[model samples]
Target: MLVEGIKSRPVYHGIAADPRARRHIFVLEGEGARALLEQEPSLTPAILASTEILYVARGSAGEGHVEALSALGADVAWTAPTVETLLFRLKAMLAVAHMGTRLYISGTEGFIGKAMQVALDQGMDYSTIPTEHRGSLARRVQCVHCKGVTEDVATTPFTCSHCGLSLLVRDHYSRRLGAFQGVCIDAEEPGVRPEPEALFL
Candidate 1:
């Protein structure tokens, strides 16, 4: 998880079943399914019937909980083989989603950001959606120089996936880009790089 007090960090206020919602859309990845599963007690049979669950069983923090997610009996519980497939399905689902639909997302920070990006693109106000952070704390980082995005960054002083420069992952985040900022760490000295730290995993 990112350090507290980072002003740009998205605050996850957790998710709950909106009793009045006619359609409930849950997008989850890896161990994030637990965020929805744990709320079974709060979900009524009718609410569960109207719910649609999309889960990615494999990711940075896979828990092999596809069977468990299916057991929840959401009307359209489907597990995608990959994240790309999941996003494709999610976009389609959101396109025809009704007015009373409520979007909920849970996953690693990277997955959360990506899902939120999709929701935002579909004209959903991010502030109205409920989000829960779960599983790996690995970050999605963007190199300032080449502007290439590197996913699942668990260490500090990592090499930029786009540029060859060594980078220091910063706490500053960009919700629009859905990534954390990574700056060249050895720009001043050119060759001096610190030991990598496993700060987010």
Candidate 2:
């Protein structure tokens, strides 16, 4: 878990198997969690015995995994189609979630960010949450000018879909916004522009 320099990507460690933890909430999206489970078969029984798993997945990729999880006698809940609906469901779940609950999140950066936002809103501490970054590195950006969120923004120096401003996605991440701050690249000079560069490279 040693992060090197300022430019380094966040390094995430594996979730610890804490026997003392009373209630577990496994929030998983996509194939990452499933792959982890497959790699460590023993983890499934332990998870099933104590956790209430909420899975949010799109389409057939998750179908077989969901069935397998169900067969293991897991207390599972599949979220509705969209991320917004899933967030809503998570909010309702967190309304009654107690202190002993532990959160294990596995998904894309944006998906995990959204889930983490909900957890943070519910006052869940970072120590109680362990996330495994999976899927794409694509970021979700929020436009400061219009307060609009641009989802899965793969690159920077792009036009903001909301305010129609050419934005420079900053490295600074906002947990509250669940995105990097996107500022107008040409705001200072008005007509001047900076050449686009690869984001997070």
Q: How does model 1 fare in lDDT?
A: 0.88
Give the per-residue lDDT digits (tens) of candidate 2, residues 6-82: 35233456554456677777777775456345534555566567766676665237357666655556556464567
- For candidate 1, write residues 51-137 as lDDT tens digits: 999988865344547877788888989988888899989998999988999999999889988988888889999899999998888
For candidate 2, give the lDDT: 0.70
Q: What's each prediction's clash count? A: 0, 0
The local distance difference test score of each candidate is 0.88, 0.70
**Worst ten in a row by lDDT for model 2:** 1-10
- Please identify model 1 stretches exceeding 4 Å from their true place: 1-4, 60-64
RMSD of each: 2.1, 4.0
Number of the top lDDT candidate: 1
Number of clashes found in candidate 2: 0
Best by TM-score: 1
* Residue-level error in angstroms, candidate 1, position 178: 1.1
